[model samples]
Target chain A: MIPHDEGNGTSKPHAPRIGVVFGHPSRQYAPGEELVVRYDVEGVELPAIRAMERTVVWYTEGKGEEDLGVHRFERIDDLAGLAEALPHGTITACLPASPLSYEGVIVKIRWCVRIRLFFVAGRDFVSEHVFEIGAIAPARGVVERVQ
Target chain B: MRLPPFFGKKRGHRRTGSQAWGSFGEAVFYAALVAAGLCFAGLLLTGAVGIGPESAAPGWMRGWLWIFIWLIPGALLAFGVAGVARTVRDWGKSEERRAAAEGLGTLLESMGQSPAAQHPFPGVPACDDLVNSPGTILRYRLPIESPESWTLVGMGLFAGLWNAVLVVLAVSAGIDIASGRIEWVLLAVLVPFVLIGVTGIVIFIRRLVLTTAVGTTQLEICDHPLLPESSYDVLLAQSGSGMLRSLVLTLEIEEMASFRQGTDTRTERVIVWRDIVKEWTNLEITPGVRFETHVTVAIPAGAMHSFGSGHNAVRWRLVVRGQPERWPGFVRVFPVVVHPAPPAESAAVRHGATADGVPG
Candidate 1:
């Protein structure tokens, strides 16, 4: 199904029937803004999971080796209960000011909320939802931040 | 087809007489310094007091040699004293003279020989057609054929022929090794050729495939002036002749950052967001004809506007890839500028245009 047009409305579906979404409806966020990440799980019968971790990472993609800066990581509720019933949870992370999301001819910087669900099988289910993080809008002049 | 003047002209260089004269004078001055040092060394040795043996030495000849050596020292002293006096006099000059001297030094420091600025070399300017051409509002068409396109064609032919030769040689070597007719040392020699053959074959196939579908890609943004959050019609026009087995068009915004390492500057391209705007199979176009299509893409709000400077840049491009059966795929990237979203009031007016005023 075609996702909604809102930047924040974009969602990614993962293995084990998991869906991830961002709480804020827009993908574009100002620096220092709180990133609210929402996750939902379907079905309860599954292998015993070890842990669920959600990380906010800013990364580069394209033309060169990928580089990532982990901004936040928080363990979520136990995965066992989510399998018994439909599970829903949200994680809030405060964003930092740097490495503002950028796009260029040879390089692109992206900010995404990555969710990883670890299973005892040593395999992890990972999914990410990308969003834009920019500086606060200026009144008239352009904001020039050098990194 | 005639290419734009910007791309047609080749850079020309001419060595000027002044440059040659300057170099000659510098060489002469340095030679003179060397000669002076050599003369001083000879004077030092000739002026030495010892003769092989006092009895075997001619006293008159020694005396004459001493006189000549003494004259050499006198000349050196006179030159040194003159140079010191001239330097002291120059140092006592007025402020104006000092300023003039400083300005001359700066000018010489700043002077450098580089490619003449008058010629507009292709590459950046060629890719910046959208900005250079003012009338390119909705549709920006590439002017004539680019040297890059020709290069692809040439490289394809060269690689293809070379690969064929390598393949023949490799097969012969392989048969020899398989039949145990060649020495083990021959295997070692054949390994490198086989590796090169395989690499050449891949490059040859890739280049040929690209050449088969080589064409210019043009981009047309639906909105006269693109605005954020609003869906705008994105148009792609591919000009070429052939049947494409699988073709895909991708729209992406990427941010690029450049840093310097030693003397080389490297750039990194990170895709902010990308989507396959269109995909097709068995698409056919008239030979030597233009084919155009329109798709819709929303410029996500909060995305940075196009940026460029010395060290960093952000760019938006419509990338099209075409794959033909048994042929290598080719990609064409068209640069587009996403101007800052118009003011809210202006956007409203643009959207408020009468239905009749809108083009079909």
Candidate 2:
């Protein structure tokens, strides 16, 4: 049973609202700090990967901070990609709305997000992380993977 | 009872030669302090050579400046020494017991009787695709006998210092961030990050301090995202030294990827671990990586899983399966803070409990 989308509708602020200091793919949040946003005020522990699965879909209202919105954080790995994947961490998806700060998830989410091991080469050959874009794609930002 | 003049008199300690080695903790403290002293002296030597603290200070001087630098190694060496001593001591007793048991069995056999000892460290259910990555240096489960102070101190000194070193580097980087003058020498900040390794060494110490009271060994396995079901061997042994009484049993447990499991929920005992006697520790296992491992006690006919003072608290012997031979075991003990049960009302109170979060 897929869980419902958890976005705005409640009075309390969600956890911490995240913002970008001008759009830059390589830079946004600190290396270890998390990017958080919510529909309500209470701080909620963000759910994560389940069993190292390839992908997960979060349902959100896709609205700016001013308006009530819903969004999703698909295969978003790390803060930079997390912020870049969604221009403003927005996912345009609709589902039967339910409870909590997090919208309902369909499959149990993968607990650990695997990031590309950049710089040190001789790994998976691909210089870009285009493959991950589909999972973390904004309404736009979709790119092709070149070998 | 007139004895030789030396009989019960306070005697000189047993040392083959000179200088008795200091206890593990003291030795570690000395080693760290000595190393730091040398580093400081090296800096001063450069100062003597007309070099000032500004640019005159060499790279080694900066290494000694991290937080809790000496305390880390000192604590770790103490902890590690404690663990090794305990292991060695237990190792001796196990050998002795086996020898005595064998001797007894032989004597009884001559008299036409069977006085056999149970097989040492019975086998456990074999796991499928057990993984020990290159990243994992060593892994083991707690035996009936846990390692002592030096062991933990050694582990702590190493692990804590290692982690502390990293924290120091990160902090220093954060400090250096303001000026934005990080001289990255071709992917090398040239910063001596050996301290980071030092911090990791003291990780065990931090763990010891964190978990001493909460529980006797740390819940190590089954926490990693892609966790494997593992078991360690507890070698049931007898001491080789005949004079000592009280049997010393050493059970080793190692980690394995996956073990034998029932096809479905129809069977209650899903996972099983066979001991040296071939007796199995069966688990009512579940499907995923998380909840497949658990500690379940047989509830009395009318008992429910409850906890209050002593009336409701459930205390059961938890036997986690491990491949003891696969890796060396460590008993990392530390002081821990125990918390009262969460209020019944707030759902958010519990984070990582059970397969849902943490095991109660």
Candidate 2 lDDT, B1-360, residue by residue in tens: 222121222111111211112233445554565565555545545554323457555667655543344445455556655655544444312122333344456456556533343221111111222223211222322223234456676776666565675676666666676678664542254245654565555566455654342222222222111111112222221111111111111111111121124553211111111112222222122222222112311111111111111001111112322222222222322111112122122223122322212111
User: What TM-scores result for chain A when each predicted structure is judged separately against the true chain A?
Assistant: 0.70, 0.17
Instruction: Evaluate model 2 with DockQ and give the value.
Output: 0.01
Instruction: State the C-alpha lDDT per candidate.
Output: 0.55, 0.26
The number of the candidate with the highest TM-score is 1
Model 2's CAPRI class? Answer: incorrect
Question: Any runs in candidate 2 off by more than 4 Å, and if so which?
Answer: A1-147, B1-144, B147-156, B185-278, B281-360
Candidate 1 structure quality by residue, lDDT tens digits, A20-114: 67666777876667888677755423455665666677666544445555666555445554443235677688776555676543555678776
lDDT of 1 by residue, B65-89 (tens): 6667657645655665555454455
Ten contiguous residues minimizing lDDT sum, candidate 2 chain A: A125-134
